[model samples]
Target: MRREDDHPKEHCAIFGIFGNRRAAWYTFLGLYAQQHRGEESAGIASSNGKEIRHHKSMGLVSEVFDESSLDALKGHLAIGHCRYSTTGSSLAKNAQPIIVDYSRGTVAIGHNGNITNAEILRAQLEAHGAIFQTTTDSEIVIHLMAKPTYNNRIEGLKGALKRLEGAYSLVLMWEDELVGVRDPYGFRPLSIGKIRNAYVLASETCAFDLIGAKFVREVAPGEIVIINKNGLKSIKPFPEPKRKAYCIFEHVYFARPDSLVFGENVHNVRKRLGKQLAIEHPVEADIVIPIPDSGNSAAIGYSSESGIPQERGMIRNHYVGRTFIQPHQFIRDLAVKIKLNSVGDALKGKRIVVVDDSIVRGTTSKMRMRSIRESGAKEIHLRVSGPPHKHPCFYGIDFPSKDELIASKRSVEEIRKFLGVDSIGYLSLEGLLGAVSFDKKNYCTACYSGDYPVRFDENVSKFATER
Candidate 1:
């Protein structure tokens, strides 16, 4: 069965290290740091200049690899992946850092985003008798790279990348070369770092910090960065888009608060959003409380801006399993109940304001509100840092269908009533953009505005090609 959550799920995390004797070890650490990005499965592939070896399974990073497994993958060039499966089902066969032996030696790929045109491209390739081993959109790239028309590996890679549409931040290793590529529109985050003489690539900078790597810069949009013994070289083969579409949700919720995403510190950006949200919607309350982990920074900003004392009203169980195998709805509710517990002392008899990042399905939010009410809160006002998520996200976030979104059809008043909250306030789209430090036009708000930056076949369901 599929694991379900109220929040949007990130697709994957990719990490690579070159010019290091302990490349696999460093890659392991990097993926461990960004484990928040994906938790369904983890994998790592390494090249010892002549051969490529890999290990992957349907589990967390720590569960998938240990010292013995890392030691077996002997190489100075390695790439790793942790996935939550936006394009494929959560099965062992779909685990990544997919290795392929082809016309141009062996290459391993670890991808971070979704390919919107995968189904169309897959059909075209299938017509030509191309065989696929896995039901993942990422395999399409390897097949394209194996085409006979391209003369060299780099040319083949560029040709394949140009044909792809939607989000992709890839880490590819071919023999001794370690490469990273970002889509022209830059819908996902990828960064470059250096430790000693080694070059590192990862989905977020937090990975670099874990491996003691110095932050170099971000992989530019439409750029391919190649790192080998000779040093790092960059090439841009595709035409640039008119405007960049960096995922704004990275700051609002997806990314680790300690990481730098799209050239801005995530925690700082979230604080700004909270401050802006407070400016947009202010309420008189006795105490301000956050929804825990994701809501911590924003709640701080809200408390600071509103001049209300902030308290930890809810305690999160960090050790809770990602999913529960329950036979009944009540059992599932018990699983959710164990994940968070309301503090009666802080919330009891107090008019409280709860700050959260976003409300997706509203089921979890409703449960949380019920918990607060049971804790004796006199009044509860819910404030969201970002605008209501009304549409599905086709680019890497595992957002539910439009009908599944509570805000898709219901009005604010109806949603407030459904959640059993005194009032609900979501930051306006303008306010969300205002909080971002970069050009507002560069960020994608498709989940809120239904304005997709990269065009896709509207008729097809986002999961049409997934197995």
Candidate 2:
């Protein structure tokens, strides 16, 4: 498991490919490209049109599957999942591409977001004598499918989907077809692509790029696409939501810079955010630097807008795995040290401005700033590319309780003092909304503004599955 990061933890990633003889291999490559979204576990399920096969394990994609494992999963249609347990324990059994043998042949689902009403639905099913195999919110869909009143399978799937309350970008596979669906509000991203004779579905366009797939388009909000030997068909099963709530964090932090999500390129949007941040809060400094990869694009925009030259002031150790064994407390203190190191030569006696994405709990930012100061920086100013995170996300992204978020309780000056930085500036809410290419009203600023489009029960934590 990863330590509490400086930003909210990514929800999950899902990918699927149809009509490929080497479906599992290609799905593996797609999941590898999306590993940054989730690293707790990886899984893939493939079908030969008669039956479905799957392999899942509790580790990174590379660690979970090898030559022998991938070779065993031969099929024409495949769906893969990489998970970060937002509501349940991080067990291998919970790893997805959740395959089940229902009455209408076998089906597997790779899900990318949380089902807010999982507990309520699970209870209702169990009262009807349902016995669940796993404690993930995603399993509720399979159970609902098994008990649907509709005779037609597509209608049944649609019925099951309509019952879901919150975020979901799903890729489902059965004997002869592949289906992809996004919730009505589009709380998570899902994309379509094509390669050779195959059709593809994934959490981001970056995955499609990895396997040489042509960019198609985003699976529409409240839309479902079904692919078979016949071709692809679209289904609009649910009523339109009151308004769209595309997770704005995807542009700020969650997505890979190379991906196109929610109608724009993530890198370009982030650069606009940086330039806007500089225009909103210009700081006079000797040099501008990014925390690392996530902050790189924004730093560039900041440099160009503020006339401050940007350089790599911090070096990242990419080899550091999510978990490591530390024999002593002294070694444990080096958690931040293991992942990041200050470029001392660049920082010595310089008035530095550190451009970072966001500050979640303030712990990581404090550690980073302390490290930068110790490297002989005379003045340090921190610039954030997004607004203060004041609420925990119930849609998909995993944030700690509201009290754990430093910005939730502290003012700007308080946070500056806590981090020991000379000054701090966060991008304004107006600046953030302006940076996105889509309609500002369509994006979710719930975490920043506490305007949740969908409300969850206060007792949400009781639902182990969330199922």
Candidate 3:
């Protein structure tokens, strides 16, 4: 059986550097820092102002490229991608920084979000005799750019972007220029950074931190930035929407705690969310323990607000890969057990409060609760940092369908009973928005409130482009 994480799968991470001799190395480091965003595969493409060369494989950044591989991709401008297969099957052919040589010139692209309208567009293009190599929606961009219909416009990139209907934060290497683009709705995060004279663009500011680069600013919702020998140039190709739909889940779970996304620090925002959760659902407990890694910041805030001591009740095995095979049917819950083991000494005979980012399908959460109960904990109060995820997400996040969500049909009390916890509390939608600095209307709470900013066909599967 295919083993999946309890949480929503993360989107891809994109990185690019211009005017740096060690561009490929820096890109590799950037990808390494943002590996949490994607872990299935990694690739890097570089341009030497003349020819474009690339190396990609179905593995981690450290596994895919070595010193010799980096040396072989010699260039002053480079772009990289680490992927999680949001739209296509996990295969070597789908690994990206997908390079192509067309009529305009050699161009490579690293994309971080999904295209909701790819199925419709692909059908139209195929009707006119267009050929495609990969099943990924990312490849549609290249075909659109190469088509005479879009290329004949003022600019091929802008024209192609105008036709797209969902989230996309792109890093493109077109000949000698490095390009970055964010969709008009701003459903994903992309930022600009600088190191010495070189310009950098990445999915998160944390990538800049790893390579000794300084955070510059975020690429605006509808903006496209081009970096070449002359300087950096900006263009607003699409009209601004009535409101921006920045994904709030980035703060709750996706981004690294040290990274800055959407003009706010992720760690601070998550702490605030935890504080809010404590305010809404205060529980009397002797100790607060996080789910680990993603839940650490929130647990700290919970402990601070409630005056409960914080402890590591459960330890995670970081070396465990994303997926593993189930050797036998009798070995149930082995995936969860392998990833986390309860600290019996810390949990035995203690009133424990467990904090986690969110509960998706509840399979892993149920198993975790059973493990805690087996450790002799007197009481187990489960706290979630965000509101219940009741709807499917179409803007890159790999959430299951609505029916698969535990909260979609069950009431809070029912869910608590199912998980076998003493009580369960999730942060309210209003409380979640209050934790962020931006206006409440600027955020997308579709997964909680079913208020999608962009409209899409309900019947279309998220993996419609997959063959």
Candidate 4:
């Protein structure tokens, strides 16, 4: 409901529909389901073969669109995006389903991940007399595709995608066709699904379920799929990378528990992570409690494994909006306090094992623990399902840099003391790998292990673009 936890945030979610008469309407529903990915912006672009129309704004999906607005974006093909700004400012202009016009036709793109080479590419494109419309990395793809290097639009798109060097799962709408492409590394999630005869695509399978669409499969790494009146056609344009660096943090955090990602159910993997956490760090607490929503599944698993009773020690207010204007220093802390309230009945006089997914900055964990202790809790033992986020993520997840991470410089004991918890334990990198239903080598654990799968140029840093 809020950024109360220290978990990493996913960039955004993308959804596209082709050959569906209810494209715009279904797009709204899909974006609503994926509002968790991004609350700062919501947008949809639609095309009826000849004309393209779009509506986007800096707000949640429900706040941005109404029945009249959805009806106005009438088309058989549409692509929608709900964004959590990772690389750009949280402004309305940066809202996605970025629509552009070129010689080929109208093109709109909704991108789900960050582009690591965006700074270099943007500079190169500008040197070639390119005029940029927005400050988003997503615009790099549009400019690259708009160039006249290839004979056909499809060839141009393929070449443009080949030049991309970071996480991107895209939903692009061209005249008469809707296209979906996942980066060669598969750093983000995108799936192909169907609602009867109409083909659908989204950043997660959860979007399909909301609109009663049947999930088919994931868009292959380095592959592109085009859906038009002629039906779905596949194009493999790039060779697979040596290692597919799918973000494992999708299971630990960043993903909605109801969604399926990286070929595994997010909820199931999180529960398994909790079970593994208990095995790795056993404690004798009277009751197991989660921070709520983010920690709910893991706490349940911990209780199941340790034979400790599970209770809802905290209640989350689901209606908390993304932003609030605070006029005072004490009011600033309302960001976390407004969303969570310690249930005194379950927490009072109990030695509690408080389970959470991860701790990004120690401030949130520290403040949350203090609130629990003030609620008459006797002892608070903090257990995390994911390993310490010690390094920055270069993919879609917007994790803070090395200096911002509490675990980067401090020892575990130091972190426990800083957070003011009786004790603190985090899942090991090995244990986290064991919990996810995939081979360890395939998933990227750079944030936890400080081992980046994507190499960087000598001149480039994660902050190059921002700088």
lDDT of 1 by residue, 292-350 (tens): 88999999999999999999999998876565477777777765567888999999999
For all candidates in order, the CA lDDT equals 0.91, 0.89, 0.90, 0.87
Assess candidate 4 and give its lDDT: 0.87
Q: Give the TM-score of candidate 2.
A: 0.98
Position 356, candidate 1: lDDT: 96
Q: Higher-TM-score candidate among 1 and 4?
A: 1
Better of 2 and 3 by lDDT: 3
TM-scores vs. true structure, each candidate = 0.98, 0.98, 0.98, 0.97
Span of ten consecutive residues with least summed lDDT in model 3: 145-154
Flag clash pairs in model 2: none
lDDT of 3: 0.90
Q: Is candidate 2 or candidate 4 better by lDDT?
A: 2
Residues 15-91, candidate 4, lDDT per residue (tens digit)?
99998877999999999998888888999998878889999999999999999999999878899999887544766
For candidate 2, write residues 221-241 as lDDT tens digits.
999999999888998978887
Supply candidate 4's per-residue lDDT for 269. 88
**lDDT, candidate 4, residue 15?**
94
Clash pairs, candidate 4, are: none
Ranking by TM-score: 1, 2, 3, 4
